[model samples]
Target: MKMASFSSYYGSLFLLSLFSSFITIALGGTFNTDFDNLFGEERVDIKDDGNSMTLTMDEYSGSGIVSKNEYLYGRFDMKIKLVPGNSAGTVTAYYLSSIGSQHDEIDIEFLGNLTGDPYLLSTNVYADGIGGREVQFYLWFDPTEDYHTYSIDWNPDRIIILVDNIPIRVMLNRQSIGVPFPTKRPMRVYTTLWNGDSWATRWGEVKLDLSNAPFVAGFKNFNANACIAKQGTSCKGFNGGKNKGLDIESKRKLQKILSKWVVYDYCADLRRYAHDGLPYECRKENLLQFE
Candidate 1:
């Protein structure tokens, strides 16, 4: 894959935003494999005439999918039904990442738990290969029972993770605080289900039960509105300009979720950052201001 330069990424975003002024783009639709152009077909099971895809994991192998086109910045959304029952050691990961050693990435990893325990939603961001910022939360609803919409809204200013349209977490651009933001590289959307027994459950306490092997995860309703940079030019139909920061209601929703369901936060993990205290962006004042 050819790596996109910082100037090209930002330039495409600017052009896409400008193009949106004269064109009205539709939103909220199904993703067709023919149009989306996905790779890693052999790694996943496709159904519904390619409208839906499933990833399965067993003792022998796991499955995954990746987008063929790279996107600069946009709102990426998908509906996923996670593995049910005692799913310890299983991890369903959906993320976007740039290629190379110093790549930038945004992640949404679902850590499986015992039947009655809630799934842990682990979120992290990496820029220029420096990423230890991990925040974990427990969903209010049973994730394995039904499909839920998970979305990532990434722009030049910030990144927001939403569940069913409600904001759950927000990571602002903290470049001034020495935090590297992902603005230079283009990333492709990817999803996979694999065994993560070593550190996936209770710090590896729960091991994978192969009796429950072939655990499956369903994915559909793939929706993305963002700037697509190809060959140093902005692709047409890139309509993500309208996506913006959180509103007052969204902030309230995020506050409610954090207060009730957030299990772990990098901002509060003093021990993990004992050597450097907390990152400047994770300071109490900065965190409170964002909240």
Candidate 2:
């Protein structure tokens, strides 16, 4: 397939404008305190007056929040501003996960970095209690500078991760190859700011600097429309409808981003797959076949 030039990708900025408008309508209204809910108070502080909410993490403890309801499959989007400055050893994570020992999960973790270095954006998937499919990337812009939209679009067929409307990663369902896809269980959207000093930065090479304690991450526009799953009942399908998938133009934009910004991809990591070969989708040369 022919790749898209950087100029072509830049020319398509209007699509992002359209996406932002669509999201505003889909989300219903501006973020307010009524939507602000907390899970852990001691570590998680909530100042929901009527607008957006901010979460902070310190040496003493970290904080997190969960959606009030669970979802099966659909699009989840959030505008987040990550922790700024010497945030080495900290992690700002957002993902979906089901309960139990054999639960399924999709992760988007921002691994903190030292000043002047880029944060490592890590993505992973877990199925039936097994997980190791890890991919990492460096974003095109400074995430801590401003809030950017990050989205996860999940369906039975595939999973797509988007940053500012540009596709960064795509994970196809490989159930045909005896691989497990997240279909049966319903998951709740969760976000957390934590101290992962042991392994968050360069595999622990950079330790957390407590002097920059109480790191803060801001969140807003938590807009998600999907099928709600209730306990003791079968999950309802996405009756509300699925989000738009990548079109040829969008794929072109993604190609440009990946070529210039992506630092690591599990599909191309020979060291990780040396012992057992690449995953089914990777070997099959699916959408994530950049390398």
Candidate 3:
């Protein structure tokens, strides 16, 4: 019995060390309590000593907020609880964007669903103002019931989108292969609750139900462990330092989600891009990396 106890104690220590290794390699971030109102001030509310905020969308207008600083690359996180019930036409979006005719962007848009339907999470990346890369998925959990962490890890090498720290989608940097990657510009984090009725639900088949008006979404715990553009190119304390690709465990989880929950991938739609052929990064080897 004594030997068994000793074994168990050492095993616990081993596990703790393993976890600490992961944490130590990444940069730490603090929760942001404030943001600049992008629009519809009356429809936005900040509470809990700026620790939390909510955005509302009514017939008159919707609301948005933008981070105070622009970041070039890093891990950005937001905990959000989506609008509830019959929210078919609304879209709650959290993304990063730079301004200009030729800009770069990374998006995480939640397309609202009917009372019992699942929400659709759509992700896309735009480089140099041209964007057609889109991949959509259905989450494993009911997003409206509670806050869930949605995160984006962007670096020079790749872009990873995660739900509760599990990567659901990843777009690797293929600039070498002639694929446009968002690398040069700096982006400000933005979150908004707005109506996208014309194409948000069933390709616009389902319009907004204003009867359930004043649709709202909750947000809190914003963290940006990034290289602020005003600072320098080197992100000294950014999480996912040095643009590491997925570790073995992360790759496994990504493969599982892609196989089970992915609803749409622009790369696989032959009809849409038959003339263009598949995108440069859509080759078999790239997809096999996670598998």
CA lDDT, every prediction? 0.81, 0.77, 0.85
- Candidate 2's residue-wise lDDT over 46-163, tens digit each? 4444235677887677888777667787788888899999989999999999989999999999999999899999999998987878878899899999999998888877788889
Candidate 3 runs further than 4 Å off? 1-34, 231-243, 284-291
- lDDT tens per residue, model 3, 1-291: 999999999999998686544332224432244368899887888877677889999989999988777777788889999999999999999999999999999999999989999999999999999898999999999999999999998877778899999999888777877788988787888999999999999999999999999899999888777766653244433444554778889888988998999999998988987897877688676553532
Of models 1 and 3, which has the larger lDDT?
3
User: After superposition on all CA atoms, what RMSD does each candidate show versus the true structure?
Assistant: 8.2, 9.7, 6.8
List pairs with backbone clashes in candidate 2: none
Q: How high is each candidate's TM-score?
A: 0.85, 0.81, 0.85
Predicted structure 2: clash tally: 0
The window of 10 residues in a row where model 1 has the poorest summed lDDT is 31-40
The segments of candidate 1 whose C-alpha lies over 4 angstroms from its true place after superposition are 1-43, 234-241, 285-288
Show pairs that collide, candidate 3: none
Error of 3 at 16 (Å): 26
lDDT of 1 by residue, 1-291 (tens): 235687788889999787766444334444444234243345577778666888888778777777756787788998999999999989999899998999999999999998898899999999999898888999988998899999988877778898999988888788876789988788888888988999999999999999987798999888877666566465333433444566788888988998998899888898898997888887766663553
- Where does candidate 3 have its weakest 10-residue lDDT segment? 22-31
